[model samples]
Structures are given as C-alpha cells and as structure tokens.
Target: MGSLEEDELVRMVRDFIESESPSPTNSSSSNCLALSHRTQYLILQDVLTGETSSEAKVLKHVLKHMKGRRDTKRSTSLRNWLVKNLKIDGLRASLCQTSWSTSLGCPAGEYEFIEVINEGENGRTERLIVDIDFRSQFELARPTQYYREMIDSVPVIFVGNEDRLCKIISLLCTAAKQSLKQKGLHVPPWRTTSYMQSKWLSGSRKELENPRNDYTGSAEIGNWVPPMVKPRKMDLPSASSALSCQFSNMSLNCCNV
Candidate 1:
C-alpha cells in the first residue's frame, strides 16, 4: 500500500469506470461500488503516511467531497468504493461462519459452537448457549418494616427481605411486561404472569438469587429487549418441564428512558 495523490486516486477511479477493469459480475456498478469497491479503496489509503496533519486534512477534504454526493442515492452506497473492488476478487471474508455439521439433536443456528483443538481432537468444538440480561431486583432489610416507612431513611444496600423482594419482582415484571409491549410483540396471556415476576424463596434465613444493586428501572439503553415473543412456548417437546425463558434462561436463562 502506497500513497497516491488525491487527484491521482480520482483519476484512477475514472479510469476504472472507463476501462471497467474489474468487470462487474452479477452485481450492478452501483451495487459493486456501495458494497465492495468502496471497502477496497479505503485499504489503499493505508499506504500513505496519513500520519502527517497535512495528509489528514487532505484526506478529510477528499472524503468531504463524497459526503456532498451522499444525498444522491447512487453516491450513498455501503463500501467506500475501494471495498467494491475487494469483492471482485477472492478477498471477501465469508459473511458468516461455516464448517460445522450440526447434530440431529440440535437445530441450525440454535447452538453456538466454538473450535477447540485439544485432547487429540483436531477441530473439536463445544456447543454453548449464553443468555444474560440487565437485572434489577434485590431484597430490602427489615421484613416487618414497609418500604415507604424506610424510604426517607438510608436504603439498605442489598439483602432484599421477603417484602422488598416482592416489590422487586413486581417492578421488574412490570418493567419487562411494559417493555415487551413497547417492542411491538405480545407476551402470551398464560405465561404473562410468570414472566411478569416470580417469587421463589427457599425458606427463611437463606438468600434469594438476588440481582445486583444497579437498578436502572429502565432498559440499559442499547441492551437487547427481552425475547418474550414466543409464538408458542408449551407446544415444544420439553414443554412439561420448561419453566424458564428461552432467551435469558441462564438454563439459561429491561426498561425506559
């Protein structure tokens, strides 16, 4: 990779259009530019010692020229122009992973497999499923004391007592329920109550599977919305024993503004 003057680069692009050096295959010239050619050209910039302030400024100016054309749909493609060139050859990274023949006991894309070569297995992989979500709920101290009474007082850090746990369960459930509504999906009527909240305390003196103290009361902004959109949860083979979410079961197995 070496630096060519900005004007030289422009001239090269024009020459590409004239000669059509990389013959467009099934894709249109616009498609090639947006998706592939653009990426290819950006890689070309690396050859230059863009480290200099003057170089950066010039580069910025050239890029600005493209921005002006962006409003034109033809100008606003995915790859910068260089990327389009990359796709013309055998340079494109496969869009997704390949090489695993999933087992009959599994479904496609359902199980995640990671490559591991150990214990005499050359390309062995382990099936893994990870489910996690922003959690807000914990016990409050003083079972006999109502939260309103203790509201003005310093909040007990952790240890949600039965009553506090009840509230947390209620609020989290409500929050989840409300959030599901916002996602344009419906939580099933039968499972709605369970998803809303559950109280599973073993006995007194023990601890609840208490969540952390960070209660956003809102969804962690960009975090995935809970996947409560099960078209049918009970019809599956494991329905009788299933009591958890398919998406964050931590069996496994958020919010507002």
Candidate 2:
C-alpha cells in the first residue's frame, strides 16, 4: 500500500478503536492504538532484516531450519517442533495456550502459540510471542485489494514483545472489521479485537521436555536435526477447530493463529 493509503487505513483503525473504547477520553486510547506507517513497515523489516538481538537470532534460526520441513504443515506441529529445537539450542521455549470466556458478543475460544522466555542481564526476563503463521490470523473473507496489500506486509512468522504484538493485533483486527463492513459482511465475533487479543495475551503455558533420543534431519537450509519424540496428545481444542465446529453454518475461514 502507498504511504497515503496506509495513513488513511491507520486513521480509520484509530477512529474505530476510539469509538469502541468505553473511556470518555478517546485521545488516550487513540494514542495507545496509534501505530505509524513507519512503525508498521518496521515490523516486517525487523523479521526480514538481520538482527543481533537474541529473539531475532532465535527466530532466524528457527525459520532457517523450518524451511522445506514437510512435517510442520500444521501450526500446532510447527510450534511443537520449534519448542523442541529451541530448547536443544539452549533457549527456554514452550507451547502457550490462551483461552477466553464469552464476553461482549464474542464466543469462548482457545488458541495456541509458541513462547520463548529470555533471561536477560541482572535477572531481568522477557517473554516473546511467536506465531508461526501470523499473517493468516488477520485474513478476512473477500478483502479489498487495499486490505490485502496491508496484510501482505505482515511477516509470516511474528516474534515480538507483548506490547508490540498487542499493537499489531489491534491494528489488524480493526482493519479486518473495516474490510468486512465494506464487503457488506458481518464481522464475526472471533475476528474482533478483544478476541484476537485474548489469543496471545491470555493463556496457560505448557512446557514440553526435549526428547531423549536424537534424530538426524536434512533440509535445503542445512543439516537441521530435531529430537524424535512421540506426539503427545493435547485435549485442548484449537481456536480454529472449535470455532469451525461451533459456527459451521457461518461462511468464514478458520484461521489457526
């Protein structure tokens, strides 16, 4: 999207958020939701560009190894593989499941994503949210070319701090609502900002131990080896599956973010 169009989209999102915010002072909330065009550009840049940050390094390593891996077709499988391999590389990685109760017309739902905890200097710790298929989360049904271009800029794999992730979620959810409205479609509750925020911001953490046995693996990137472990059964229902089952009549695409 061009700079002028990008600015207009941001303004539209900002206005939508402020209108929905319960607080009388919309400016305060608007300020919080305000993500400049440059900031949005940098989100993709941070993921694509080489960076020395620990999180960036880990993201790069994971992406490199994940390339051409046929076993990671599903989001859950991809996250599990990443956690196991990241732990082998001496990083504290785990699977996080976030679920929220029905509220404000949104249905109850659960989501799964990967989380990596970084223990920094002086005992400081940072938690990063890693969504392997991030861009798919914001995809709308029959989106306009303008909206499609905006979403295309989102990185496929998103690794960032909570604040950064929240901002992105807010921006995308608002844009999704606008796009749907333009198409004369009802914005499903699952696509709302509150629901999207619940995906990453709220959940329980499940840490899987590295498998004792090691298996050799090869890919175009290099000889990437991930431990061989039995596929553990998770009783929790993924948000996509749950929503699809619940809203079978609704002609909406289920996004497993």
Candidate achieving the largest TM-score? 2
- Ten contiguous residues minimizing lDDT sum, candidate 1: 127-136
- Candidate 1 vs. truth: CA RMSD? 32.1
Cα lDDT, model 1, residue 188? 43
Report, for every candidate in turn, its global Cα lDDT versus the true structure.
0.28, 0.65
Model 2 clashing-pair count: 0
Which segments of model 1 are wrong by more than 4 Å?
A: 1-158, 188-199, 202-257
* Candidate 1 residue lDDT tens string, 112-148: 1111111213453322111011121222222222222
lDDT tens digits, residue span 26-61, model 2? 212244235544453444243334233866876876
- Candidate 2 Cα outliers beyond 4 Å, as residue runs: 1-52, 70-72, 203-257
> What pairs collide in candidate 2?
none
